[model samples]
Target: MQPINKMKIQFDSKSANEAFARVVVSAFASQLDPTLEELAELKTAVSEAVTNSIIHGYEQMEGIIYMECRLFPESIEVIVRDEGVGIEDIEKARTPTYTSKPELERSGMGFSVMESFMDTLEIQSKVGKGTAIIMTKKFSQQKDRSFSSER
Candidate 1:
């Protein structure tokens, strides 16, 4: 909540927009001197959230995706929001390998990956309304432990 720097950007909910989200998030966080691993995790998490918004939330149709990055002195928070068909079952959605569209090759790992990458991941969705994801990671002087694997 208390970030040293804050940034906000909005882009179309398209697959192409995913790259922008990742790049911008990484660039903004670069000011903190986060490790490459940390930056990658941030990018991956952002990609998942933005992809979900574009693929599921907006159903690939043209829509807007709002992303906010808050860089704290010892932590970071990224919020992604979409004004599209909201999630019906947030509990189930959070479950690993749970995808509303299984046929879409989606691993349903969006929420799972976000949870794994960040210290906190929260999702709020309402049917026919929209979905918002709030992800936060607190940095520690200790070695990076946000994930089990180095990659």
Candidate 2:
């Protein structure tokens, strides 16, 4: 299905930008008229993805983070990407409580949180290249009038 709407945003990989990214996505997703719980879930998922890119991907160094959101009739897809170090083992990274940087006291639950909050989570990474996280959520109550009749 074609996207009803789409938005792309690029920003520096800084911890401060994490909140900004979440808010931006929340606002963009507001058009869907999701319930408060759904909105909070999306915001939390976005926060996790952005934080992972800033901390794990860039390792607190300078880098760029790209995010794109696409709105479909009943679902929204979000992509968060970074240009920095990538995960060597995606499976290991997905494991609960598995952290590459133990010195930082990382919780290592970012991916888990994203997976729990979103309908689907996909990760693509290459060492020395970067990492990209794609997440999608289907709205149970769609606000788009164009598709309301189908319901």
Candidate 3:
């Protein structure tokens, strides 16, 4: 299906931009009129993905983070990408509490949180290239107030 709306943003992978990324994506998704809970979920998932890019993808060095949000009739698709060291094993990285950087106090729950909150989560990475996370969430339709009035 064609996207109703789309937005792309690129910024330095500073730890500061994690919150910025969440807010931007949340604002873009506001067009969908999602419930408060859904909005919160999206924000949290975005935070996880962006944080992973900054911490794991770039290792807190200087790099670029790319974010894209596309709105469909009933869903929103978000992609967060970074050009840094990629995951050697996607499966191992997805495991809960399997942090590769124990020294940094990384929780290793980033992927787990994304998987739990969003309807779908996909990760693409190359050992020397970078990593990209694609996530999609379908919003539930609001109740038809007009139908209640008619009844």
What lDDT does candidate 1 reach at residue 52? 94
Q: What is the lDDT of candidate 2?
A: 0.92
Q: Supply candidate 1's per-residue lDDT for 126.
A: 91
Off-target runs (Cα >4 Å) in candidate 3 are: 144-151
Superposed Cα deviation of residue 108, candidate 3 (Å) = 1.2
The parts of candidate 2 lying over 4 Å away from their true place are: 142-151
**Per-residue alpha-carbon lDDT of candidate 1 for residues 1-151, written as tens digits (9 for 90 to 100):** 4567898999998798899899999999876667888889989999999999999999999999999999887788999999999998899989999898988888988888999998999898999999999998765546554552345
lDDT leaderboard ranking? 3, 2, 1
Q: How far is candidate 3 from the true structure (C-alpha RMSD, Å)?
A: 3.1
Displacement of residue 118 (Cα, Å) in model 2 is 0.4
The whole-model lDDT of each prediction reads: 0.89, 0.92, 0.92
Task: For residues 1-151, write the lDDT of model 3, one tens digit per residue.
Answer: 8999999999998988988998998899887777889999999999999999888899889999999999997899999999899999999999999999999888888889999999999999999899999999999988564663564
In candidate 3, what residue range of length 10 has the lowest lDDT sum? 142-151
Whole-model lDDT, candidate 1?
0.89
Backbone N/Cα/C clashes per model:
1, 0, 0
